[model samples]
Target: MATSEQMEAYSQFWSLTLGFAAPFALKAAVKLDIFNIVSKFSSEQGATLDEIIQELRIKHDADSIQAERLFRLLRFLVFKKVLALNGARYGLTPMSRLLVSHGSSSDVFVGGILSFCTSEVTQRSWQHVDAAIKRPGDSNAFVEAHGMEPQDYVAAHPEFWKVIEDFRLSISTATSATITRVYDGFKSVKRLVDVGGDTGSFLAQIVRLYPHIQAVNFDLPRVIANAPAYPGVENVPGDAMDFVPPGDGIFLKSFLHMFADADAAKIVKNCHSALESDGKIIICDMVMDEGKELHLQLDMMFLSGSQRYQRTKAGWKNLLESCGFGSVRFFEADPFSITEAIKN
Candidate 1:
């Protein structure tokens, strides 16, 4: 017979397993624009369930059953603490307020991230995790489930890819802000080269913050073509693997995690070669550390030969030092780390 304590622990495991339900519910709420609808109709007393349903136009002639089901969903959200219910009305809580989409430029697309994370294409990858473990190497969950890489899959589905792209852009904006605020080494650099800089957003933020710094956003030719112009920032067309534009400072913001260690080392060597004698190399990325098990799980979800995975602090230090850089230092930021390495 199972002991009471052991059974209790098993029950807790089941509860943790059921955590998927919350994200699924949140995904539906995002699709229905529940938060936006509630925000639009909210008053001092908050909005009634009927008002929300009416605003969303989800009612039909057979109303009771559907209304009850919608009520159940709303009540789930209430139970999850994303919303609140008093009397017959529901109101947005701080958590729910994040779903409201409002911003003209450089807005963080929290809703887009929510949707993309729970989207069919992304969730499909999780379904094959078991298979990936059973059969390792070049056959990740994503590859097994989709029969193609993520970028190729996105190219085939333009509309869906746009949402993912929006999420990427939002992440880029947030990352740029963090790098700009915490890292001050940019002051010494006259020329900054952003290797694999996508859309020039990072360089744009950097040059605007430090007017004295001139930056080159270097990526593939097609990537450079689509980059937005920023004052004192030039978009250069070339592969970083082949050659990085010679500069006093080399910035690799979220660039290296996508490649395997060997390839990343090659890119780091390229940075070393391109950097001036006294110049510094800055890398903005997730650094695996203590109490980051959840981050490790998310890292594993990328899966495969040269997928986006984090490096440990020591791993980063060793990698930089191996690339002929000395005096490496790490600056911790929100869910990411900035590593600075000076040429030997």
Candidate 2:
């Protein structure tokens, strides 16, 4: 009775409308530690529903009903490709592997971001996105929803701070690997400074690659106070908005996207001042490209949660050039892009 094309369009409309289902399912799996539990077994062997339930320590008087509900959840996850099913056993898929925490500080886990984004606080903030859009002058939806800035909220709630820290560490770990592989501009540097470097995690990786370079991990006093000593990396407590440490090469990874253009420019100007003659400043942030869905989605999140958004290539050029940098070059990288400029 219905045309095939018409049915297909209807299906797509429903899928887009119910898109929240997939991410919420993922959040549940991560919260239940499903990936980590299944990761203990080989894919070939996998983990049975019963075994998974045992690991979860789920107990009920009506065991069969509980198992059936969980099985349905797992089946949904398998359909989403977050998990794989071989016969009656379940295993972690490649996507699920990124969600598993191996208890390593350097390891990247999507769970933190997943948990943070799905939490009640974040969900409430999304409700005010319309308010943020209609409001005048740099209004943040999160601030409107929570009555405080994101950082202040995190500080107030220690649990959320841990989630934020985990998310940052995961992103920094992945970004550091890409930087060391694709960008060779660091080779000429004698001293390098990482602005807003959390616990020196990223700077540690850089110094490990180039032992000749002296590295400074610069951040606020509270952040630096918790930083462990990494060989060849000095933890310096300071604010980038006020003063950035002097260095021939200054790095800002996933930092500029946190501010509006004017504030970002001020930070860059500070980096320019701290640079020696002919010194370089390297930035790692999302440079929005046409048809890149992830970049656009991140831009939306920035729009709703803060007064920041991803920059386009022209925007990056304008910001850097205005801050007294020359010869800006952009490099393609996963999760983030690399931009390098030299002091004029």
Candidate 3:
């Protein structure tokens, strides 16, 4: 007979193996927008099946097998604390609030990250990781399978692009919320440039909130084409990896961790230079040190994106210091870790 130690080791192995189940749940939740759907389920009461069907304007019948199956899945989410259910109704938990209801506006960080990570196309990319491992390849799975970069693959494959667009739509509401949450911080700075600010959506939010703060929307020309005009805000098409707009403050919204350390340093160095010797950069990304187990699993799930997990505050501070910036301060901006760096 195997000893207790052997049994415990097997438990650990299966536990890791069952980690795939988490993403499967995430896939369903993102599709249902269950967080948002439940939030809208009459703030005073949880929803019933009929209520959910009506709210989402779906075609499924109340007693259909599909509906029953979906309800069962939702019950599981409630069990996991991802969705909160009360009697015949459903609602948000403290955690779901950071997702579905973004105080006032869309914080695409919540919407974007959740959707993209849970997507079918991205899921397929992870399957090739074992192949990547065996070959001594340059990439983990995504690049090896597609023979192209993530963005390149997306642009070239319409099927994958569909999911990306849908994913974008899922979190489209959160961009404004992100700005609303940090309006005070932006207002305090004289000149704030949003680096890699897609479509200038968040930049527009800042302009609407604080008319006095001069804003710059920084991104590639293709992305900036649809960016709306805001008074006192200049839209500049540029690569953040090579350069950043000169300003008193720089904003990076959910951008870092897309590259490995070497590339991250290149962008950090540019921001360090664009600022006054005393200027600070505002980074909106995960702070690994503050992460819970749920967040840790998420870091693992995104291994395909950059083969990088979220960085701890200490790690970030060390990174900034090495990149020619000093005097780092980490702040909790609700759902994201807002770190600041002063130019040396």
Candidate 4:
């Protein structure tokens, strides 16, 4: 019933809509370790189905039927240009080569998306996107759809909790480049307090860099329960919302994005109060810009999953000002910012 121009628009829209198919396809590929196998085969000449199954040391039986299933999967990966197929052998494309194991380093390239997409909590919430978009105020999307909090369900089921933790540990590690870039000046910092510093993961680097600089790693008690006892680093279990330990430098990496404005304001205020006369607060969170295409997609992704959200440049400045922080400065080069301020 539409005109030619309208029909053309509709056709293009549907094609773009099919783009969602790629994420699921990629998730499946990563879950099956297809890319790692392909990359390994590339180092060898190439791998046939039997060779792939054997090399991967697959747990289950891989007979002719299973081999045929794997072949069909490889064909899809080949068609997607993530894997290269020469005659009957499979190899990795340049795009897929980054996922291979590096000596002993374990990097699951698509692990983040897989954990988010395939987690029982996230999977259940995916079914209610329409309801979430229609209904209005920001509520927990997972709870809204599933009728129970994701955390509660995760707590009740040990297997699901293990999967979630595996996904977190697999995805939370830093790339070497990112580590060097983010912590370029960490050696100069005198004393550091990592708020919500779950098990001293980020603080370990700082304490390692400056052997004398005391590190106070604060988080919920349960989170830092098994924290390793180190000489320069002190582990204390408590909520950052109610209180933060006093220190020279306050640090938070990717923790602020999990809180709403009021909660963030309180935490920042605590940080402001906790800092020594010459100290500053270090916030490492994604700053969103509406102008960038990728930023917009990331903004949407954050909105869909977590209730807490990113702040625009102006929004962050206002947030800082409201919390009695002065001299807010953002580094364009960094995904995070070292915003210095005083309590007046």
lDDT of 1 by residue, 1-344 (tens): 99999999999999979978988898878777777778765445778887877866752333443678778899899999988888888987777776766533224346666776777888888888778778857667887788887767767877876776676676776677676678788888999999988888778877877899989999999778878888888989998778889999999877798787888899999999998897899998888875777666557556532246578989899889999999999888867779999999
lDDT of 3 by residue, 143-250 (tens): 766777777886787677656654554443454465355545666778889898776666666777788778899999877886777677789998988788899999
Model 2 quality (TM-score): 0.90
Question: Rank order by lDDT, top first?
Answer: 2, 1, 3, 4
In model 2, state the lDDT of residue 64.
43
Give candidate 3's error at residue 211 in angstroms. Answer: 2.2
Error of 1 at 58 (Å): 9.3
Candidate 2: pairs in clash: none
Residue 229 of candidate 2: its Cα lDDT?
A: 98
The C-alpha TM-scores of every prediction are 0.84, 0.90, 0.77, 0.80
In TM-score terms, candidate 4 sits at 0.80
How many pairs of residues collide in each model?
Answer: 0, 0, 11, 0
| Runs in model 1 lying further than 4 Å from the true structure | 41-51, 58-67, 79-81, 84-94, 103-107, 304-306
> In angstroms, how far off is 306's CA in candidate 2?
1.6
Candidate 4: C-alpha lDDT: 0.68
How much lDDT does candidate 2 score?
Answer: 0.85
Ranking by TM-score: 2, 1, 4, 3
Please state every model's RMSD to the true fold in angstroms. 3.4, 2.8, 4.2, 3.7
RMSD of 3: 4.2
State each model's CA lDDT, in order: 0.80, 0.85, 0.71, 0.68
Question: Which 10-residue span in candidate 3 carries the lowest summed lDDT?
Answer: 101-110
Task: Please identify which of the two predictions, 1 or 2, would achieve the higher TM-score against the true structure.
Answer: 2
The candidate maximizing lDDT is 2
